[model samples]
Every structure is written in C-alpha cells, then in structure tokens.
Target: MIVTRDLTKRYGRTTAVREVGLAVREGDRYGLLGPNGSGKTTLIRLLLGLVFATGGDIEVLGLPVPRRVRDVLPSVGALVEGPGMYPHLPGRTNLELFDAAGPGGGRRDRRRRIGEALERVGLAGIDRRPVRAYSLGMRQRLGLAAALLRRPRLLILDEPTNGLDPRGIREIRDLLTELHGEGTTVLLSSHLLTEIEAFCDRVGVMDGGRLVLQDDLATLRAPTGRVVLRTPDADRALALLDGRVEGRDGDRLTVRHRAPDDLNAELVTAGVRVRELAAERRSLEQVVLDATTTTSADRADRAGGDPA
Candidate 1:
C-alpha cells in the first residue's frame, strides 16, 4: 500500500531521513519503531506528502506522492503528532467539522458517519462539553474518531496511543485488528515496544535517519536455538543432559536444544519432574536494540544541530 526508494529528506544542513527504502503491503499491520530524533515522524510526513522529499521516490496506494497525493489522500487517514481540534467545540462538533472539510462522504450521511466514528472510539455518550474540558485520553480518542470518519483504506498513525491508559490502548489495538481483518492497511509508528510486539505482523526499525531493519515480526523474533526448562528435578536433568546444558539457576536450566518438545519428552521419560519447558526466543526489545547503534540523546549530541 506504501513504498519508498532511497527516500531522503534534509533540513538545511541536517538530514532528517536518508536512503530509506520502505515497503508496506496491503492488509498489513506494519509497525515503525524508532527513538526520538530517529526521523520516524519526518518519514511519515514524507510518505503523506506533507513534506516533500529531498531525493528519491514515494508511492501510496499505487500513486506517486505529492504529484498525485490529492488522489491518494482521500483513501488515506493519518494522525501525526496528534489531531487538531477546536478547543471550544464538543467532540461531535469537531468530527462534524472535519468531515465537512474532507472530500469524501456526502452531507446526507454526515450525521450518521460522525456518530459512528465517535461510537467506534468509545465516545458515544459524550455530552456538549468543550474539547478543553476533556481528558487527555478522551482527546486522543476524539482524534482517532476523526481519522476514522471517512473510512480510510490506509491508516498512517504516529504515537497513536500517546495519552491513553492500558485499557484504552488495548481498545485501540482491538479496533485496529478488526480494521486489518476487513482489509485496511495500517502503518503505525510507536515507541511502545510491547504494544507493537503484540499487535503488528511486520516491523521496520529506523535510526540516524535510516531504515536499519525491515522484516516480518515473526522472522525477526525467531527461536534462539535454545530452550528454558523449569523442573524440580533440576539436578537429575542436568546430569542426564550434561553436555547440552548451557546455563542454570536454581530449578531453571537453559538447554542448548533445537526442539523444545523433544527435550521435554526426554526429560519426562527420564523421570525428571518438569514444571515448564519452552523455546527461547529473542524479544522485540533485543532485536531493536541490536539493530540500532545510537540512542536518541546520543544522536542529538553527535549531530550538534537540528532535530529530525
């Protein structure tokens, strides 16, 4: 649904994005992971045609960006940094104004569309209170409702769960899952590693204005050729698999085994009382940290200049 080739963006002397080749497929819940000053927001703006690239190409929904952004934008909904709203107006009013300003959806169904959008974001019973009176989470939900007002085919979101509690975050995740199931392509950038790990199918990591890694989440987090075994018979298991055991702590043993099931069966058959056994896998945090060379603060200090 979105593709870029050697995409570059520069701000005066500083490069915000450099040589980024991004690929987001249709019906994909792709997560863009990066630290501050990593150019994630800049990259998103480049893809949405809000900021023109310094070099390279961009395509969204099969159309060249900026050149055909108008054609592509009708099907694309985005929330970057945050949503803009009229502080004096209620949430419903804010959505109504946004819908009217947009290109798609006629006036005949505008009211229904507004209500449905609000309901989808869990603000169905909202009263006529100004947006300034709403909590941070409520405003966040209102922004999401505005994005969904036009039933966009592609959702490009940045820090989508910025001001929400755990429950609200889970609600948004479930809502995105439902949309993905129904054929909407989602590209969301977030610093929340756990959220992305649990929700996204594909992931891309950015650092120092470059896309350092891109792959399916499962591939990036493949098993680490080891198993973690918890058993009361730790001594017996260690004796039986002395050569294969790598590390041990109390009743838990880290065994250098390729197949966890085979290891479990071997232990059970040997009269070792096994409590739990599972394959060891690299967590998303490990993958991201291994890919990125610098922290946001380190990058900022090294650059000694502008923010990406």
Candidate 2:
C-alpha cells in the first residue's frame, strides 16, 4: 500500500534522506528501524506528504504524495511523533472533537467508532477522565485510538511503545497484531529492535538516509551454523584450526562456519573435548547496530570526519 523509489529529501545544504526505496504490501506489519538521526522520520514525512521530497517518487495508498495528500490523508491514520491531546478535556470528548474536525463519521456513528477505538487500545473505562490524569501508557493508547477512529486501511506509528511499561508494551504489541490480522497495513517506526522483532513481519533498517537492509524477520533470523564453544584447550584448538577461531574467553572459543557439525566433529577428532556447543546467532539489536554503524562510518569517511 506504500511504495517509494529513489526518494531523497534535502534541507538547504544537508540531505536528510537519500535514494531510499521501500515497498509495503497490503497487510504488512512493517518496521522501520534506525538510530537517532538516521532519517526514518524524514522518510515517513515524505510518505505522508508532510514534507516534500527533493527528488524521486512516492505513492501512498495508491496515490502520488503531496499532489494527492489531501485526497488520501483522510483514509490514512497516523501517529507520527505523538498524539496531541487537549489535557483538560475528557478522553472521549477529545476524540469527539477530533472527529468533528475531520471528514469523519456523523455524531452517532462517531460515538460508536470512538468507543470501539478506545476499547481496542485498552482505554475503554477511562473515557470520561481528563487526559492530564492518564499515565504515559494510557496517553499512547489514546493516541492509537484516535488514529483508528475511521477504520483506516493504513496506519503509521512512530515509537508507539515509548515510555510504556512491560504490560503496556505487550498490550500495544498484541493490539498491532490484532489490527494486522484484520488486514490493516501498519508501518511502525521504533528504535527498539526487540519490540520490532516480536511484532513486525518485515523490517527495513535505515541508516545515513539509506535503507541498508530489508527482509522478513523470519528470513533474517534463519539459523547460521556458527557456534560458541567452551573447550578444555582453547589455545590448542586455535593451533589446530590455524587462527580460524575467534576470541578466547579463558578456555572458550567462538568459531564461525558454514557447518558447525563439521567443526564439532573435527574438534572431537583432534582430542579437544567440547564443554558447551551453543549456536551463535545475531540478535535483532545486533543486526541493526551493525547496519547503522557501518553506514555511519562510511558517511564519516566521505566527509573526512572522525567516525562517531
């Protein structure tokens, strides 16, 4: 439901996004992962037509951006930074005013939709309370409820789990899963890879204004035959393997290979009894860190600056 090609955005002399390409299909629970200044928000803004791209093409919900923003925005629900709230107003009243401001449902239908949205975000009982009294998690849920009021086909959220407790985080994750099950295409931006790993079907890693990696979480986490072994003689193993082994944690060794079974067999044949044989797989956080760090280092090289 969203597509971009060579999308670039600039501000004066600085480019915030560069040649970023993305495609999110129907019912995709996609995550955009990046660090503090890696241009994730810039790309989202370009997609939303909140900011014009300096170059390239973008189409959201099958309509060209900026040109079609007015026509398509009503069908797209977004909580980009955070949901703005009238702190003094009751939660339900806040939603009511929002619906009244937009081309939303009539009063009767709006009330029904508001109730449903509140219930979906786990804010059903606190409808009559002022938003100022709500907790950080409650406010986040309220934001989500506001977005879902129209039953939008596309949902975009930035850091929806920020400041949420563990239970609240779980709540939002389950809610997103439920929405995706109902065929809502969601594009979520978050710095927390664990959360993204748990909830997102596909992920795109952005860094230095570029999408360095994009793949399904399942495919991304497919097992590789690398192992961490605690052995009786680490030095002896390294001698046998001729420096092919990495790192020595006292008597432990980390070995990378296409076939860990073969390595284990060879180690056993060489009279090095393995104490532990555990697979070494990169976590979601590690994958993201590696991608963004590489991109940042490359940028530093091009700019003739010290690496961050």
Candidate 3:
C-alpha cells in the first residue's frame, strides 16, 4: 500500500533522507526505527505530502503524493509527531470537530463514527472530560481516536507509545494488532526498539540519512541466538573456544553463538561439565543498538573520529 523510489529529501546543505526506498504491503505492521536526526520523520512527512522531496518519487495507496494527496488523504489517517487537540475542548468535542470536518454522510453517521473511534481507543467513558485535564497519555489516545474516525485504510503513526504507561502501551499494541488483522496497513515509527519488536512484523532501520537495514523481525533475530552456561571449568571453556565468550562471571560465562545445542555438545565433548545452561535471545534494543552503533562507528572511522 506504500512505495517509494529513490526517495530523497534535503534541508539546505544537509540531506535528511538520501535515496531511501521503502515498500509496505497491505496489512503490514511495519516499523520504521531510527535515532534522532536519522531521517525517519523526514521520510514519513514526504510520504504524507507535508513536505516535498527534493528528488525521487513517493506513492501512498497506489497514488503519487502531492499530486494525489488531496484524493488519497481521505483514505489515510496519520498521527505524526504528537497529538494535536484543543486544550480547552473536551475530548469528545475534539472528536466531534474532526468528525464534522471529515467527509461523513450526515450528522448521525459522523456521531456514530466518532463514538466508535473513541471506544476503539479505550476512551469511551471519559470523552466528556476536557483535554487539558487529561494526562499526556489520554491526549495521545484521543489523537488516535480522531485519526480512526475516518476508518482509514492506512494508519501512519510516529511515537505512538510516547507518554503511555505499561497498561496503555499494551492497549495500543493490542489495538494495532487488531487493526492489522482486519486488513489495515500500519506504518509505525518510534525510537523504542522494544515496542517495534513487539508489534511489528517487518522493520526498517535508518541511520545517517539512509535506510541501512530492512527485514522481518524474525530474520533479524534469528542470527543472534546465544546461551548462558555455568560450569566448574568456565576458564577452560573460554580458553578452548578462543574468546567466543562474551561475559565472565565468578563461575558462569555468556557465550555469543548460534545453535546452543551444538555448543553444549562441544563443551561436553571437551570434558567440561555444564552445571547450568540457558538459551538467550537478543532483545530488540540490543539488535537496534548493534546496527546503529556499527553504522555510526564505521562513519566515524572513515571521518577520523572516535568510534561509537
């Protein structure tokens, strides 16, 4: 439902997005992750037609942006940056205003849609409360409700989990999962890798104004299997492996390698009795940090600076 061809965006002397290409199919729960100033927001804005790209092409829902933004926007809903709401207005009134502005069939239909949107965001009971009285999390949910009023085909959300408590985060996660299951395409952007990992099927990692990696979360995670093993011969095991050990404890060692079963067998064959063995999975934070740090370090090395 979304495609970009050599999408490039420049701000004055600096290029915010450089030759980035992306394709998100229908019903995709895709995450776009990056550090600050990493061009993630720039790419999203380009796709939304909020900002024009200096070079390349962008299409959303099979229609070219800028050219078809007017026609396509009705089918798309986005909560970019943060929630926008009238501080003085009640949450319900906020939805009512949006519903009025939207292309609803009539007043009753608009109210019905508004009610459904508020309920879907889990703000059904307290919509009458003023937005200024609501917490940051509530305002964010209200923003989501407004976006949902149109029953959009594509939902582009940036930092959707910001300011949310654990329970609120879970609710939003469940809501997004349900939306994707119902054939709604979602493009979620956030700096939090854990959130993205939990909900996104595919992810794109951005650094230095370019997309450095894009793949299924399962594939990104498959290569990082490891195991923590404790043994009386921990020193001997590390010596035998020739520095494959990552961490050293009193009598335990963390080994960074795939296929823990094979490694355990090797240890046993080498006559090292394993007292305790537990498999390890790399957290999304670890994977994201590894990718960004590697890229940043490479760039720093090329420029003759400290390696991060």
Maximum-lDDT candidate: 1
Clashes of each: 0, 0, 0
Name the regions of candidate 2 deviating beyond 4 angstroms. Answer: 104-106, 229-253, 256-278
Candidate 2 lDDT, 101-211, residue by residue in tens: 866457778889998999998878874778899888888888999989988899999999877999989999998898888888999999988899898989999887899
Tens-place lDDT digits, model 1, residues 232-306: 989999999989999999999999999998988898899999899999999999999888854445666788954
> What is the per-residue lDDT of model 3 for residues 1-308, given as tens digits with 9 covering 90 to 100?
89998999988999999999898988889999999989998898899999999999988989999888988888888898887788899988877877667553257677778778889998888746678999889889989998788888999998988889999999999999998888789999998777898899899999999888888888777644567889999889989877688888888888877778899899999999899887776667777888889988999999999875
Top candidate on TM-score is: 1
Lowest summed lDDT window (length 10), candidate 1: 293-302
Please, what is the whole-model Cα lDDT of each candidate in the order they appear? Answer: 0.91, 0.86, 0.86
TM-score of each: 0.94, 0.84, 0.84
What is the Cα root-mean-square deviation between model 3 and the actual structure? Answer: 3.2
Candidate 2: worst-modelled 10 consecutive residues by lDDT: 218-227
